[model samples]
Target: MHWQGCDVAFLTQHGKQHLVGPPIEAALGCRILHTEGYDTDKLGTFTHELARPGSQMDAAREKARIGMALTGSSIGIASEGSFGPDPVGGFVPWNTEVLLWIDQKQDLEITGWAHGHAQSLQKPIQSLQELELFALEAKFPEHRLTMRPSHEDHPAIIKGIHNVPSLMEAFERCRSQSNNGLVYVENDLRAFCNPTRQNIIRNAASDLIQKLQSLCPACDAPGFWVDRRIPGLRCRVCGRKTRLPISEVWHCQICKMQEERAIHTKALADPARCDHCNP
Candidate 1:
């Protein structure tokens, strides 16, 4: 009955385990039971119809819980993603992905993540010209998009648009539903639709593999890793404390054991990162 003897449960209905599951299996050297049939959109959706409740991490945890409940497995895994303007490139897209691992008997919960560049697009349109622009900008036909009248909850919302004919048809239909004649178009941020997001999910899986394989120095638990950061590296020029990580605090998810070690090769922060030195 215990899932410990068996493989881990990875909850996904979107055929995502194929893209993100390889690292986990390769690292853990266990079978991955891909559990499905859960309507995770009820927890939250990127298209924003039902408005995902709580944090992104909460949604992922719930998914893992559901997978474990459905399959009677003690170990479960799940992932979630968020998209927005790129932090480094200004208007370009960025994805924040999280992969979570849960074990009931061991009472262990750990998260691995990736927060960086992604190919995502969103636009609000009033005309055919604008839609075409959005399509090109989003790298459409490849990435695809979803269309809705006023909101994601719009009854006439069209999703999974792949071709120009379908795009034109959906736009005309959705435009009619809107009072202002504008349709909201966004890259379908779902795993099944977007490769960029899937790539990020894979990176998150890799991150989890690192944590899962890492044994705690104290108790030899698998989930021992950096739990937090200690900021305030001294500025090289000004010698004032700068907001850069000076150390990594490693902790065990199960034992709650904590350890802190210096993260940087040098003790001082770069002048560019120092507020007083640069600003």
Candidate 2:
């Protein structure tokens, strides 16, 4: 509990503090000082109004730094999320959440990651019936939706439509402004708007807590976790090395300490996965 009794600055406008603060404070005994002094939408937005610059990790780190700067606290935390197609099949929608912790006193930076299915969908609607159908699929009232005239990049966007009345109103507004008589409707990807994204952010916070509890054996620093994998497990049929991990390399960012632990699971790689055997 190195962070016990410490004040950690958290910057968020999407009500993420409620989701991430409780577990962290309960487990680490740190104070979460919520800050809204800066507008995070300037960094990036899901609605495509302000494009997010740099990588996901970069955005999280920048937020943490900004929070620390604003609150003048030594430690800071921030969360960032992204949506895309699932990695395995590249078909289903996917969401990835990242929670970053920056401790200036200890000169340490740690990140927690969680990803899963996302409730993200978009459609072009020409009628109220089409809009209602899209809302049903997007889980409206609970998940919320955003409407824009003509296309996705339309500046005349109406956000945070929860109830049927609001949804209908926003749809009509966008439709009236639409030159093509078509409105673009989508799930609002904001954490407060999307419950699924909120849960993923919570999971990411739990992951960050786990890593924070894991102390580096050599330097006693936090964030001791697997840094890389050593590949080349032998193929079962060919008895030749395949591009499968045989061991994992746990690392400490502080002292740059590393420990290679061999994997004991299935001694050989699947023949189907082996280049030599399958070739």
Per-residue CA lDDT of model 1 for 208-250, tens digit only, reads: 8878888988788888888789888899998999889889999
Q: For residue 41, what is the lDDT in candidate 2?
A: 94
* Model 2, global lDDT: 0.93
Clashing pairs in 1: 44-52
Once model 2 is optimally superposed onto the true structure by TM-score, how far is the C-alpha of residue 221 displaced, in angstroms? 1.3
- 156: Cα error in model 2, Å: 0.9
Give the per-residue lDDT digits (tens) of candidate 2, residues 1-279: 798999999999989999999999999999999999999998999999999998898899999999999999999999999999999999999999999999998889999999999999999989888887888899888998999999999999899998988987888788889999999999999999999899899899999999999999998988999999999899989899988999999999899999999999998999998999787
After best superposition, candidate 2 residue 45: deviation in angstroms? 0.9
- C-alpha TM-score for every candidate: 0.89, 0.97
